[model samples]
Target chain A: MTDHAPKDIDTLIELLAKLPGLGPRSARRAVLHMIRKRSILLTPLADQMQRVAETARECLNCGNVGTADVCDICANEARGNGILCVVEDVADLWAMERAAVFKGRYHVLGGTLSALDAVGPEELRIPQLVDRVTSENVTEVILALNATIDGQTTAHYIADQLEGRVTLTSLAQGVPIGGELDYLDEGTITAALNARRQI
Target chain B: MTDHAPKDIDTLIELLAKLPGLGPRSARRAVLHMIRKRSILLTPLADQMQRVAETARECLNCGNVGTADVCDICANEARGNGILCVVEDVADLWAMERAAVFKGRYHVLGGTLSALDAVGPEELRIPQLVDRVTSENVTEVILALNATIDGQTTAHYIADQLEGRVTLTSLAQGVPIGGELDYLDEGTITAALNARRQI
Candidate 1:
């Protein structure tokens, strides 16, 4: 589908279509909406994007993205507890922060260990995590990885590396806070049953 | 939910959330993805947006947006077939262009006549359309407004103004091409039956 929209407008649509969850049709709609609301939406959005493009950077310490080199979390000395939460990516780190429960700092692994993709300990920030554990005197390491097979494999590997150096724990397997029993998978149900708690 | 992400990152997410089809959660996800793919996606997108913001403008003759005073469609003398398609907005004009069937120029009404909102003929491009019909030697005018009530009301108003000046037509309502009878709405089915052709 082709419209005689200006070359710049077409380029904008093409770039917008590359965003997650937006296809060509939605991208076109978004561009049209931006054009119609040029003073309010388009100009501001463009300015914000330009600012972000100039300033956004990954946190060297935890892989979290921010305008600064170390990110706000890594820079805040108050959040540096004796516990460190290990996560697969910055998104996971952000999710944990949203829960507002984990007060300690995080260590983003970049990605899990994937033998199929030739990803190993060195490919991730595993070495840096070990260095941090020793240097920061961390007493506990929480494995906050996903429940996927790759996630479990990576967790096991990290657990082996920090075996005697620090106490290791993982997020529990059970029904989610407001999840229904009938909707859960059998594996989750079995895991929850085996790890039942006393009332 | 709040994270210790940089203030700039948070502001970017907040602005992105204002876009259509995106909530705060999706905006956060999109920001994270853009940050991760900064070099390939984010930077290029920012550049394109800035370019469009600087150059994009509405055509003086028609209401279509382009980088020039007159839009490409309006400037193309070959497309000036004495047949003008009047649309409620630029998006409808774009949709017609995507179909690649229409060869005539377009006149964007900007919006329909809405008494509730106090919008009248002067508020839209009604006078400009009337002027164009005579000055451009337009012999036919297709009202390609939407099927909404406001759309039909506006179409009838335009038809009244240009009654004897040019032949007036509108998009036909029927079962869409490849549409199934079972999935069709009652109104559409009735319309299709009434407009049935001889086999």
Candidate 2:
């Protein structure tokens, strides 16, 4: 920004630059766009951010982000079909919800177990997940974790803890709905071939 | 976002998506990052945006954005070196300031003369610029507009109006600093060749 730019605008750009994908250049562009569209973008975005700051909270039972102690998913009774989907992060939980295919409640693990970073089950919501499995009418546990090593390690640990208590399942690994075989890696091709089914 | 997402959080994501270079997916990622770093990013960013919304205004003298009627460069007596650098927009003016090469104050044209868009001298700050050139101790005018058709047309218009009144110049054309000759376009190479000088 110019040295003559207002201190407030400079600070806004600085803060916006700290976001996930934005750096100084893109942040400046975004700020310029906002200032040009102040009524439509700047003021409304500020008001909305303030509202989220005041109201956003973590769900007490599932660790999902919402406004109340328990998230709407965790509070609803019809969605609980004795199946609890375990995810690695709130973003993943939200991604699952967007599909609108799953009718079961969710349990957010916050993160996967990582020995290099010194993260463990205690650091995640693994204990809360185990407690929910026992308290809720959960008959099956679906581990929808990523295919990363740490995600698989965490899944194996959870399975060991509830080996015989509930039925354990995981998301099927194969070619995605719109995926092409030419673009897929060997591991995916092998999985898809091994899991071949008849129509 | 999930159907169970808090209404305020959802609204925040929607508003953030309206920003330039950001879409729904990036907005969700940004919201997640802000919520994770609430104290360091979300609250402070919201507060700073509110402040900018209340204080930011276009300078009456030059159309630059600041917290006052007159921009800092326009008000600074030391910068009045009898040279006014004319630019097409506030962002262009800011880009010039960042280079720190020019010492004179600036005149933001707000926009270039565009017949297709129905923009003319009246729509821009052309009248104000003409008044400044006469009222101020301006001995020269630098047309630092972009190398586009609209920009050239605007420069020609300004030059015709202010001919013989002041020594007028435009930015030099050539390969950019650190630009490779192999990657430069033929037009740039031609311009550089035509304007070549002895070392």
Candidate 3:
């Protein structure tokens, strides 16, 4: 609530501060930079934000965000390889896509089941995922959940529910492609060693 | 250009990455957060950004960014205390305002004199600052430029230009208040000792 800038500008700063990884000080600096570069950066960003606000929506089938009811992957016939990749959130799905190795449709669970927070099977998209597996004729389900305790619990629950119905899999635990062994945590090092290849 | 998200969302991320302190990863996260909280955060932020984009402008008298030709500080008669504070940029002016100790109006020079970049006094608002000193009946001018080499050079040049007309003063150089001696650079320590005051 700085009196130095106009009210609208201060409001913009407040909103910007709410963004992840941006605090009040950085938000102020960002606002000042945008104000200075109004024509090139600020105006276009404002337009884009408005357009996204008006059009963006979650895909009804997969829980992925897009402007359409069905996300691009869910709508594309080419992506329906009878393999479904289940992720904890849209960010995880997007990360998998960035690797460009997985050539199949994805189901975003929105969140993992958290017993501590009273979150259960009904809280996430687990029911919808089960329905999709049977309806979409999915043959294999890949669980790409985070390697956290909650994520593991959720994965196990989903695997038990879908047992014998489809081939269930999870991402392998290993040393990252370019990771240095010295910098890796103890758990990762153990996993990499235990899963050591013949080569 | 990620093929995972829709075109508009990708565009939004790209534009957001151009903002200060935000990179591609943070921009993607921010876009996702905004889309997820469209009703509460995204829509209002877009509206505020658009408002500021349309209304915000630099004050003609002082180069301060506001929603009017003359900024609030420039328009305030009470702030016209016959002492003008000059800063190298709008951020510095805002910093001075944050301190809330300076009761006089500010003149933003836009940039300092950089010989390497061939930026001279004419490139800045030096001429306009001189005009304001005489037109506004100012008796003292405080040069609150940075302690950098270019900033010092600019301060000295301005002081020489307004030597006999009015009292010219530059911000004092010393160890910053509450600064640890071990963390301070040698130059600051030397300046603090040289300018030691009697109790």
Top model number, lDDT: 3
Kindly give the number of clashing pairs for every candidate.
0, 0, 0
**Fraction of the true interface contacts (Cα pairs closer than 8 Å across chains) found in each model:** 0.62, 0.71, 0.74
Q: Candidate 1, which CAPRI tier?
A: medium
Stretches of model 2 off by over 4 angstroms after superposition: A1-4, B1-4
Query: Of the pair 1 and 3, which is ahead by TM-score?
Result: 3
In candidate 1, the residue pairs with backbone N, CA or C atoms under 3 Å apart (3 or more residues apart, or in different chains) clash, namely none
The residue-level lDDT of candidate 2 at A165 comes to 88
- Candidate 2 residue lDDT tens string, B1-199: 3434678888888888888888888888899889878888999999988888888898888888898899888889999999999998877887888888899989888888988899999888888889999899799999999999999999999999899899999999998999999999999999999999999
Better of 1 and 2 by TM-score: 2
After superposition, candidate 3 runs with Cα above 4 Å error:
none
Model 1 Cα displacement at B173 (Å)? 2.1
Q: Indicate the worst ten consecutive residues by lDDT in candidate 2 chain A.
A: A1-10
Model 1 iRMSD vs. native: 1.6
Q: How far is candidate 3 from the true structure (C-alpha RMSD, Å)?
A: 1.6
Error of 1 at A71 (Å): 2.2
TM-score for each prediction? 0.93, 0.94, 0.96
Worst 10 residues of 1 chain A by lDDT: A1-10
Model 2 native-contact share:
0.71
How would you encode candidate 1's per-residue C-alpha lDDT over B84-181 as one tens digit per residue? 99998887888889898999999999899999999999889899999999999999999999988999999999999999999999989999999999
What 10-residue stretch in candidate 3 chain B is worst by lDDT? B1-10
